[model samples]
Target: MSTRHVLLGLLASGPSHGYDLKRRHDEQFPEARPLAYGQVYTTLQRLVRDGLAEVDGTGSDGGPERTAYRATEEGTRELSRWAGEITPPAPFVTNEIFAKVVVSILSGGDPAAYLRAQRAAHMGRMRELTAVKSAAGAGLATVLSADYALNHLDADLRWMTTTEDRLTTLTAEVDAA
Candidate 1:
């Protein structure tokens, strides 16, 4: 989900300073999706420019005064429309392992070496994902987020393993021929 939508959703609940928004984003967004201060500020600026949030108050944040933001009527309307229209979907990350392996094969590099690296990577991912799910089941994951992460991880692991198996089978058959 866009930071715009998340900030607006937070504002819908209550007015908050930018730092608070940042904290909540850390909680909600995955670690891979780590947002920097610049991105948050930039997105907030866009929201302000689009007539979504307005400065309501200013306060100290451990040192300096930070402007608090609240949703404007137009902002609320936009946020609401966005919320209804935008059901957050899982992020789509391109699989470089297969692509790179293909490139290596075409370039006459050792397929086994590349595939070995890919195997390690995918296996490591599976183990990590399994650990995450276990931690979630044990109620140890951050923000009780194991379930959402687990579901996706399972999907990914399944796909990775299946793809690897199919590729290996194809390679073996072709080599035999």
Candidate 2:
């Protein structure tokens, strides 16, 4: 996920201080890993440097003065373009699992055993995610995130099954190469 775009979207609501942006981000993306304060400030600085955001003003909120930021016209246009664009699926050909399987075979190890281990690991993770989803209650963000992960794990399990079925042919092809 693009932190830049996320901040831009938040700023679209209104000008906000760095601390406020961090709070809003956590509220909006409950399932996401928490953002560090330094990361928030760094992203804001980059946005300001790139002309995507500007420091609107500074305010004293009973402590140190906090600078408020607002999105620039260009930033809004960029955010719109990003929102409309479809992200391509990640290439599975270069995945670490595939590499590990091939390496195990080349080194005269049991690729099938490796695959079985991986499948077990995936299944364990799926169970954990399922529990999380169930406990998420009605939080759409948490449920959706868990669902997304579960779907990906399901696809990976399917791929592992297919690969195991074709291991003989794959080994032959690799040996030939």
Candidate 3:
């Protein structure tokens, strides 16, 4: 997604300076990965030039003079349009959990241990992603692209659960050995 759209979405919430947009952007996505500060500021600048943002100089300190940005009507419409078009990110670009699990397996610790640790991580992530998903549920309605993302998570969760269950069964069988 264009950073301008991201900035617009953040600006739609309220007037904010560049740093504020950075914080909101971080909160919108997981911190395990982040949008760079450069991207944030650059996008904010573009939005200002695009007429989507206005400088609210009413509140600022003397040093560097924090320029508060408010969304213009055009900006609001653009933001709303962008919001309606919100879709899940591409799988290769977004789903690192699966990749992490593959790396864990290749790194060659005990498979059971790896699976257990992986399960723990995904479970924790699932909780976090879930909260974001719920809060953004409305945006997700038209976001058919999210299905691939959800599918990847769902598969990982199931793989972990099934592996855990199978490991338990195998442990019982091994004890009989």
Give me the candidate number with maximum TM-score: 2
Clashing pairs in 1: none
Model 2 regions lying over 4 Å from their true place: 61-63, 92-96, 116-153
What is the Å distance of residue 120 in model 2 from its true position?
5.8
Model 2 CA lDDT for position 91:
45
Query: Which wins on TM-score, candidate 2 or candidate 3?
Result: 2
lDDT of 3 by residue, 93-168 (tens): 4456545544544554355776777778866776666665666444754344345566667788896677666765
Q: Which candidate model has the greater lDDT, 1 or 2?
A: 2
Clashing pairs in 3: none
lDDT tens string, model 2, 1-177? 999999999999999999999999999998799889999999999999999999999999799999999999999998999989999877447888889999988988999999999999999999998898898364887889899999999999999999999999999998999
Kindly report which residue stretches of model 3 are placed more than 4 angstroms away from their true locations once superposed. Answer: 58-64, 86-177
TM-score of 3: 0.46
Candidate 1 segments whose C-alpha is farther than 4 A from its true place: 19-43, 57-67, 85-93, 108-117, 120-139, 142-177
For model 2, give the 10-residue run with minimal summed lDDT: 89-98
Indicate which candidate wins on lDDT: 2
